[model samples]
Target: MLGIFDDLAAGNLAGVTESLARDVIYENPAGEQYAALPDSGVWRGREAVVEAFRRRAQLVDVLELQQRDVVAEGDRALVVTYQRIRHLLTGAEAGYEASALLSLDDEGLVRYWRVLSESAAEADVFDSDLDERLLAAVRAGDSREVGALLRRGADPNHRETATGLTTLQTAAGLGEATVVAALVAAGGDVHSADSRAGGTALHKAVQRGDLRTIRVLVEAGAFVDAVAPTTGHTPLMDALWYKWPDVVAYLLERNAGLGLHTHYGFSLREHFEYELNVNTRGKDKLLVAEQLLQTRTREDERAAGEQRLMAAVTEGDQAAVRGLLASGAAVDERFPVLNGFNDLHTPLLVASRDGHTEIVRLLLDAGADVNATEPTFGAVPLHKAVYNGHADITRILVERPGIDLDFQGATNGYSPLHDALWHGYEECARVLMAAGARTDLVGHDGKTPLDVATESFGAEHPLVRELAALG
Candidate 1:
């Protein structure tokens, strides 16, 4: 009976099946759920018992097994064993400590068996030096050495000295999938919570948008809805923060539950809206935020949608420009109450500064004043484009019929050509020149294009040479 228990622990299915009585019954937990034996159900008969063991084998490769304790009385035996099971594809291993009760008939063939496995604390396998070696291997991304050391009886769930991070948590936090896979292959506790943050590897993968790592963790049976301690943020929150739409979709597909909320009293969707509005300010940020908000909510979802759109136009999302216009979003939406960093500019001025040509075209097409000046810069779209060296957009703006080419803003006495030449935009200068920009124009510095070019780049540079050759 003791020998039969040893064979079963070793995953020697054939030996166990041969030794068991025809009426033997075996019981264990359901597949991929837990390690405990089924409470009520039992597999009856030798062939049925063999099939049960085979099904359990399919979940993980039994790399090694060692009996820690065994006691026998007559034909019955009880044994405790530590076993390592490796994930076939990722090579990640999970360790379990299990106790099995075996009953044998008069023929010395096992007749009944039940096994119960449970999770253990990290201190069970701690060795001071082995701990350091594992941490170093994980930090350096040394997958091979990590795997070998774990195989040599090193603990996969060893905690670091300073940070107290389990190897899995540290490796996953750094986005080192190789180290993570090796640790998992070595029977590391994938569900081990980080000492500091209480988040798991799955949380780390979600935060960084490492989709491959997420897939690996998930396939290794990591808890999908594992939440961080500090923020109570779930993997979904991490995905949304990093803008990983595909990861969000994948987690959702995996039946990941979503009661995730921040300490600020906001859900993941609301958090996304807040981040899109406040964290992102520039033109591109606003546009992406607008689209992102739409993905999370409906059109009549006014609070977030309106706020995002206002921020969008203020930052210059071209599609938002068209969408707002079509949907009657306020064109002159002002932020007078919140004055610091909240000064409002028309969408056209925002488009000009960011060099969003399509947005500029949309605003113009939607009846925006092309010559409207931003309050601070006092520069119109042409002045903004020329100042920023937006050569193509400047060309487009100047080429518009009935547009004022010589439009002078209040801040600078210089025309569009003066701004172009001062900014060293040779291509813009050429375009302005081709558009009949004045060669004799003088700026606030009392210098022409040739003078500025010669002073800035020396007469030998192409810019100065082009200006000098223009004569």
Candidate 2:
């Protein structure tokens, strides 16, 4: 269907003659004011339509063609198109948009076609002053007028002819959220950079501490981490430089990248450090930026300490584990493992399973739960110690004063002693027995510790021998 225009521009009317009915009527707006262009009028029949377009082919040449929309209802269709064309006489190019209303005949050929718009190549598109009008409206904070201008065909990508400040940039710099939203909805380019700074509307929003406007821009798909070409700083780094953690916090929540630095070599934390070192200004507000960064650093450290606590336990580093606990790491955090399931558990649970005896004792002293079960199998730390044959950890756990020595596994219903003997850990079983672990506890298999041990070492198993001697 769009080939109609290409055919028209190329003076090849034969290809489109079949799609046009014998009695088709073509109407368009073109006039004497457009010198050398066809006057606004109507043409009846495919022959008249062919001649009319031939006149245009003689007057202008198409440079680029853009189709906006094509809607059809049954045999009728409407096509909205924008074209950039150069006048043959003046050798001047300009853009024009027109909507073509088309109606198909009984034979599926266009019987009635009309180009609806008063648009002219030179007048409507290069209206040179429309961009200034839109920018001024935004600068004056007139959202209503800004929207009116945009709806009336003001370019959303308008930039200051002098300073390269865009309409969206001006709205964002002024923190006018309504104007920003209106412009963005009108296809404003959020990524347009300030000519001087090479920063985008997002950077302007950050500099003004306008979180509301920032949010609007961000939601409109503004680049969260676009670096300024001049300074090589992102919006987040700009927020940090201004000492506006409130803005920084908002950007971070929007998933802005952390650890971004300036071209001068300073991270977010390093910037805070620089604030303290070369901060000879002695202003109260400057100190406030320092204080905010300090608080941010501490919060990040506390969160990192939680993961470090697990690493210390996993590596069996007793002192690191003790220091982390002393520094207020979570004593019973259920850490996730290989597949990101909450199968791994508290520092004490990890230390116990890995046979880090001193770390186990340290975590227990630091109030780590001695009997917290992992979510995967609901096995407690004592079960992990015995299953892994950490008899020393098992003994330390059994003497913890309130250890659940006979706590059954949620999956298999085995007590710590049953799990011990089932895994052939006679030493772990001995520790449980010395701690007064119940031997009469029945498991899911209807077997006791004596039954499980008899399978391991025949009748000479220690559990079997101990019970027989008691008899």
Top-TM-score candidate index:
2
Q: lDDT tens string, model 2, 1-471?
A: 566766655556687786688898988765543322453488899899878776666666777767789998998888988888776644667877778899888877888998777565554333334567788888899888787678767887877767678878888989998888998999999988988879899999888888889999999889788888887788877786666767877765554545566677776567656765775664455566556545555654565455888888888888898898899988887653322333356777778878899999898898988878885577899998999999888988998978899999877888998988888888898899888888888888898878888887689765779945544
Task: Pick the lDDT winner.
Answer: 2
C-alpha RMSD of candidate 1: 21.9
Q: Residue 293 deviation, candidate 2, in Å?
A: 2.0
What's the lDDT of the predicted structure labeled candidate 1? Answer: 0.68
Model 1: weakest 10-residue lDDT segment is 120-129
Candidate 1 lDDT over 1-471, as tens digits, reads 566556755778888777989999877644422322213247899888788777656545567688889898878788898777664433555677778888888888888888655443211322224556667887788887777567656687877657767878788877887777777887878788878877888887777767778888989989777777788787877776776777777776664544346876997667777766675444354455446435433422343345554567556677767887788765544322111233345666666666888777776776766676654445677887888988878877877776677766666567777787777787887788788866666766677768876765677988677666777
* Deviation (Å) of 213 in candidate 1: 1.1
Angstrom error at residue 446, model 1: 90
Query: Clashing residue pairs, candidate 1?
Result: 91-185, 92-184, 92-185, 93-184, 93-185, 93-187
TM-score, candidate 1, is 0.34
